[model samples]
Every structure is written in structure tokens, then in C-alpha cells.
Target: MILSLIVAHTRNFTIGRDGGMPWHLPADLAHFKKTTMGSPVLMGRKTYESIGRPLPGRLNIVITGSPKPSDNATLRYVKTAEEAVKAAEEAGAKELFVIGGGSIYRQFIDRADRLYITLIDADIEGDTTFPEYDVRDYGIIASEHFSANEKNAYDMDFITYEKIKK
Candidate 1:
């Protein structure tokens, strides 16, 4: 399975605050949904709790120390990032999206084959942040710049990066 990470972060790398995203960007949300529509998504327990439910049309694998039973067919639990990846592969996922808070990203960033990043051009204050990564590790595949709008509060760039072969 191809491991990919999808994230939206501020210029300062802030991803969340008070257990939720700091900005309201509908376009980014739509982009996220569209990109991960048919793929399995792996996330940490805190990220799962923040979403509060399984995403439709995709497998939702939550990595946590404590596993939980789920009646929701799309939702499942795993003990570690490796287990999450294994589950996605077992589910026949061609592309696995690692949608995260922080620690989860750190755990799988090195293993990620691709990155779909929304770079918000604002220094929003937040307690939770995206992990700092070396851009030299990946090559930009595509990029789209969007100006700030009434709903999107800040200008943002949607970028896709493919891991550079060693």
C-alpha cells in the first residue's frame, strides 16, 4: 500500500488548538474529502476523537494504546502505526492516508510515500502543531495557490509532494 499523509497547517506549522482546527477553510475540507474519498485513513486516538465518527466511503483506522469495539463497519482500531498500515493493506487499500494530530505524523512521516499539504499563509496561534520535516526529502509534484476568502480566512497553497528516491 502507498502511505500518504494529508494535513492542513498554518505558516507556523500550527494544526490545531483546543482540540480543533484553528481556521475554517471549506475549500480545504472539500479537498481533503475528495482526496481521501476511497482510501483508508490512519489517525491517532486524539485525532479520531476530534473527528468523533468514521469518515464515509473509506476505512477509518485509529491507532491507540487501548482498542475499542466499533459497530460502525468503516471504523476499526489498532495498537500501533505499523498495525494501522497492515490493516490498510489487508483492507486492499491502494493508497493509505495518514491523517493526524502530531505524534502520529511523526511516527509515519518517514514512511510516507506522498504528502498532500495545505499551507495556510498565516501565523495562527495553537497548542497542537504539525511536525517539522525536511523538504529535501520530497519533491513537489503539484501546487495550487488560493487567495483568502470570506470563509477561508487566509491565503493557502495546496501542494502535493512525492518522496524522492534515494
Candidate 2:
């Protein structure tokens, strides 16, 4: 399966603070939903807890040390990132999106086949950040710029990168 990561970060690569985002961008949320609509999204436990519910249109595989009682059909708990990938594969996923909260991103970034990044233009203060990675290993396949508006909190650029195959 294609392993992809979808994230929104600032210039300093800050992704979260106080267990939530520093800003709210409806357009970004819409973009996220559209991009991952039919794909299974894998996330760390904190990421799942922050959202507090399963995303309606796709399988939500959460990686954690402890399992929770789950009655939600779309939600599944896995002990490790490897198990998360296996769950997605077992569910017949062609693509698995590693949506995050710091540590989770660090674990699978080296294996990522693709990245969907939204660069928010602003000074964001956060405790969580995206791990540093060499951009030269991936080529930008797509990019879109959106100016600040009523729906979007800040000027942002949506960039899609695919790993440069050897």
C-alpha cells in the first residue's frame, strides 16, 4: 500500500499546542476530508484523542499502547505503527495516510511514499512539531496557494510531494 502523510504546519514546522491546533482553517479541514475521503488514515493515540471521534468517511486506525473499548466500525486500535499498516492492508486499503501528532510522524516519515503538506503562513507557537526531513528526496508534484480569507485563517500553500524513486 502507498504510505502517505497529511499534515498542516507553520514556517517553524509547529503542528500543535495544548493538544490542538494553533489555528482553525475550514478550507484546510475541507481539503483534508476531500483528500482522505476513501482512504484509511493512520494516526497516533493523541491525534485520535484530540479529534475525539472517528472520521466518518474513512477507516481510522489509531496507534497506541493501550486499547480502548471500540464500538465504532470505522475506528480500530493498534499496538504499533506496523500493526496499523497491517490493519489498513487487511482492510483492503490501497493507500494509508499517516496523520499525526509529532512522534508518529517521526516513525513513518522515512518510509513515506508521498506527503500532503499545508504550509500555513503565520507565527505559530506550539509544543508539537513535524520532524525535519530532507526535501531533496521528494519532488513536488503539486502546489496550490490560498490567501487568507474568512474561511481560512492564514495564507497557506498546499503542496504534494512524491518520493523520488531510485
Candidate 3:
């Protein structure tokens, strides 16, 4: 199975503040929905709660030490990152997206096969951050630049990086 990490972060790598994203970027949200629509998304319990509900059109796999009951058909629970991956694969996911809160990203960064990153051009304050990794390990496959619009607060670049074949 192919595993991918999809995230949007500021130049400082800030991902969240006070359990939610600090900026408003409708285009980024749309890109996220389009990219992970039919796939399985693996996220930490905190990330899941931040969303407050199951995301429609995708399998929502939440990793937590304490399992929570969910009547939502789209929701599932796992205790570890490996379990999350195995569950997604067993569910016939060819590609799994690791959508985050910092610790989850840190846990899967080394194992990710692809990265879909939106590089925001503004510095924002945040208590949560994206994990730092060596860019040398991946090669850029595609990138598109977007200017700030009414809905998107900052100029950003949507970049796709594939793991470099050794």
C-alpha cells in the first residue's frame, strides 16, 4: 500500500493553534477534500476531535489509546500507526493519507511514500506544528503557485513530492 502525508503549513511550519487551524484557506480545504475524497485517512485522536465529526466520502481512521464508540459508518479506531495502515490496506486502500496533528505526522514521516504539501507564504502563530524532515529524501514531482484570494488568506504553493528511488 502507498502511504502519503498531506498537509498545509506556514513558512514556520505552524499547523494548528488551540486545537484548530489558525488561518482560513478555502482553496487548501478544497484541495484536501479532492485529494483524499475516496481514500482512507489516518489521523490522531486529537485531529479527529478537532474535526468534530466524520469527514464525508472517506474512511476516517482515528488512532487512539482509548477507543471511543462511534455510530458513524465512516469512522473506525486503531491504537497505533501500524494498525491504521494495516486497517486501511485490509479495507483495500491503495493509497492512505496521513492527515494530522504534529505527533501523528512525526510518527509517519519516515514511512511516507509521497508528500502533498501546501507551502503558505505567511508566518502565523500556532501551538501545533508540522514535523520537520529532510527534503533531500524526496523529489518534487509537481507544484502550482496560487496567489492570495478573498477566501485564501495567504499566497501558497501546492507541491507534490515523491520519495526518491535509491
Q: Which residue segments of model 3 deviate by more than 4 Å?
A: none
How would you encode candidate 1's per-residue C-alpha lDDT over 99-165 as one tens digit per residue? 9978888898888899999999999999988888789999999999999888888899999999999
Q: Alpha carbon lDDT of residue 119, candidate 1? A: 97
TM-score of decoy 2: 0.96
lDDT to native, each model: 0.92, 0.93, 0.92
Query: Best candidate per TM-score, number?
Result: 1
RMSD of each: 0.9, 1.0, 1.0
Rank the models by lDDT, top first. Answer: 2, 3, 1
In model 1, pairs of residues that clash are none
Error of 2 at 90 (Å): 0.7
Ten-residue region with minimum lDDT total, candidate 2: 64-73
In model 3, the worst 10-residue window by lDDT is 66-75
Which residue pairs of candidate 2 clash? none
